[model samples]
Target chain A: MNFIRMKYTKWFNISKDGLSKNNPIMIAVLGICSALAITNQVENALAMGAGVTFVIVGSSAVISIIRNFIPARLRMVTYMVVISSFVILVQMFLEAYFPFIFAALGPYLGLIITNCIVMGRAEAFASKNPIRYTLVDGLANGLGYTYVLVLISIVREALAFGTILNIRVMPEAWTDWVVMAIAPGGFFVLGAIIWIFRELTNNYENA
Target chain B: MKDYLKMVIFVLILGVTTATVLTGMDALTRERIEENQLIVLQDAILEASGITDYDDTISTFEANLEVIEAEGKTFYIDGEGRVSYTFEGLGVWGPIFGVITLEADFETIAWITVIDQEETPGLGGVVEERTYLDNYVGTSMYPELRVSRTADADDINEVDAIAGGTRTSERFEAMLNEAYQAHRDVWLTLQESAGDA
Candidate 1:
């Protein structure tokens, strides 16, 4: 039990456990808003995933670096300041460069700051961990979240347009399923994935 | 006291370093991003104008292009290299804006580009879909574009209006007509300016 109390050892163990396909979105059902909103197209999902991953890694590093200076009462503000600065930088860069995507993904990028997945990772993992391990944990979780998003977007885009990444994969005669492009379609696909993953991993946790 | 001061300094240094790195990346990528956006916008305009895969040089596109303004919206003309017809319309929601580059006779729609709209997705979003917008490509502009019932196959301008989006279709028609009128008005102004020139 004391081995679990070791700082670096605990950070690695918890990060792996948390991101192990059985945790959060797949297992505990968290942070599904952007997963629903941005998964309509693979390009949108990739942009969102890359943005979130950057913010999570940066914020985690900043929080870990400042763990000592942040008083208990102002810890939340400190974490938010770190997360938001990264979020704004991402937003400004996207706006200045990718105007079309910036238009489409406008408010959702800002909403990443409020995403519990990011805050949760900061408070639960980064707060106590060393800087090096915290960055790894943040990267793992971000990649895990991205993996789910790409998977969901793949199904939605293919079925909706009869293609992957907008390249026509289906024959001309194939009638496209128009329903797949609507927002609700993402929810149905996400739920099915979560169910399948849970069923597959349920045995290991139980036994 | 010294430990507290050191902690503050450490936090400040980390924050400053992060900002510098992010700003540096922004500076490097800003130009490429703008270039990509201009390409997409130009492509959208070209598609609406019924021109595709033209040489990417701006001068060629600009030479064949004309601008018309009326009723608060602006339009670009394909002009068939001359003053042809104009494509103007309001969108299903917001401003249904597009450029209808026409042949010199002003009777046929050479290409139509929907520049902006706030129409409902899955319904008005069809404006961007090839199935819908492409229909406007070769439509006749003689009696005006009409949104008749789905069963009305009597005329080419009589496109079947969107089923549930009746008001949107009506607004689209009105806007289309407004765009045409605006184009006509602007075309007259352009003539006046040219006559003086």
Candidate 2:
């Protein structure tokens, strides 16, 4: 796969579409609940980002492989089952290997089952695409969500706790902002970031 | 109809496959997960008793901490006569588990470590924090330990509670007092036996 001319490739296009044009957060407006809940801390954001990425890749691959045999009436049900299975695998692995993160994530770990982005990809892309394309799409979308979350968390954690990844970056006299550690603070930061992202990308939706 | 049959078969296969995979994963990881939990509890106990930087947690814990069971109660005795015991009780959302180490007097706290808790982060979750638990140090659990917003600064028995987590503070107060009372009886008996001997 010589890729000096990578911009012309189908995989590149799918990835570009996912990472920028149809981002899970800035463009698609998907998976906001988790984005808000976990972005207060950089560590939680990273853990959640990794977890969601894994779930998305796992479920998308499974759904794409079985897309042909899936009954029309069972489409939603199939997605639910596949997604939940992957979520449970994530829970078990984290509890076993990273118990600290497992405890930190709390209810949000189980709530991955309800994330719309995973199901959205399954229905829109995986069901219609081959596994090769599905994998790229999943990776691109997962990274897209993750980078945005990390960005938001950097801002929130710095302001909320005067630290970045638990390292004290702010001066000793810095007063912590309680709002940034709570849900409403997440809303404000996420909204601002989304607006700035849209401005930079020129993604405007007119009524 | 054939479509209905297809649906049923697809569901059955998916269910069985998911079940099999999860069961296999659980079988593989269950031991490690259980071990990880035990390691946390053990480490907390060791750290509470001022033990750290050991080669292996389990071995060092066994070598250092002596466990005694009396009246169906278990207590870990450190070399320095400090006593540590596991405590479990309800927090606001779920259970809180920790090890509380008391000084030789059995009244003043040596150290306290929250091994596991399910309180809300940045609020009730501060119960597990080192800074918050540090407040327990030198505080007497004699009579009862009070967690209050207006903690009497001079009173060692009263410590400042989490500012935004009143319910959690109240629950924590009750939980600690209950655990103290539960373990105090066995501790008293051991003290008397040692005095006589």
Candidate 3:
């Protein structure tokens, strides 16, 4: 079991250097811009998470399948083409079925193409990995993003509405901190979350 | 050179596929989307006008209303009944639009619906929620309705503004007042007609 597991982990599992030591959105903090902009509402955050998950998975799979064929000089362009196509598809589908969320999310859905997390995963992990491992990386990164987004939305919604996800979880007498619904509030909460995650996962280096 | 041509062909193929799929979906969904919107509008008119069970078969109230533009804004009214005009204004950074159905007297506000707004979701967007919009239900003004700071239901001049969204409240007041003034001149004619009758 050790021999087989180590062999698998060696290529697929994030390296110790990549783990808690270089957490993508926290320590390394590649996609913090979007983290701040789209964390104001639970609805937008959920839509964003879905869009990112779709784009990341699609891009990862596409990149892995074509990795051997892509010329080194043309690799970035190829990834961009693949990623942007998925982003447009997600945007169109959301507009069709969930126009309200699409309108709320506005231009941010299209911006997923530029989110460093997508390109970073493709370049850093998917390009070198097999299909199975490429998927693992995509799933891990998507979950990582969803975790942060949900955390931020919880704090923002609770403070703004005196509720969590529209449920009146707070006491009647509690005063909502109004600023928490703003973008600046998202930044502070997200920073604190990244810091806490870093401290908790500190033992695993880059776990 | 050949590789570049192949890449170009691939991009063209993908682009065409996406455009065709999205356009086809848009066409199929357009009618349903319009039907859904008409349904909401019908519901709103029925709810606000305080008329119910008049006709279940009706889908949309053909707004016989006309838009009269003046002073960089638009006011709407129809000949049959009193003028019920919608006003669009800015609440904080987003848009706030409402329906104010004037009574036959034209000065009193019979019904007001904050039809749509794009203020902060949980806080300011509460304009759509019952607690805030309900304040305007059955609301009337002898001269001009005023907004209160707290729950001053007794205050003749004020309505209790949403606690955290004071800016939105202030904007609504200003816009409503502007709308009231704009409609005042036309309202005089309706009053004159009532007097003659």
Identify the leading candidate in terms of TM-score: 2
- The docking quality of candidate 1, as DockQ, is 0.21
| lDDT (tens digit, per residue) of candidate 3 on A1-207 | 676677566444554334444656776787787777887777778778878988888899988987877766677887887898788778767766776787778878899999999999899988998988787667767766766787788888888778775688889998988788777898889878887887787633433
DockQ of each: 0.21, 0.76, 0.13
**Worst window of 10 by summed lDDT in candidate 1 chain B:** B79-88
lDDT by candidate, in order shown: 0.73, 0.92, 0.72
* Candidate 3 docking quality: incorrect, acceptable, medium or high: incorrect
- Which residue pairs collide, candidate 2? none
Using Cα atoms with residue i matched to residue i, what is each candidate's TM-score against the true structure?
A: 0.67, 0.81, 0.61
Instruction: Kindly indicate the candidate among 1 and 2 with the higher DockQ.
Output: 2
Reference interface contacts recovered per candidate: 0.15, 0.96, 0.04
List clash counts for every candidate, in order.
12, 0, 11
**DockQ-based ranking:** 2, 1, 3
Candidate 2 ranges with C-alpha deviation above 4 Å: A1-8, A157-185, B52-56, B70-72, B105-109, B119-197
How far in Å is the alpha carbon of B178 misplaced in model 1?
Answer: 4.4
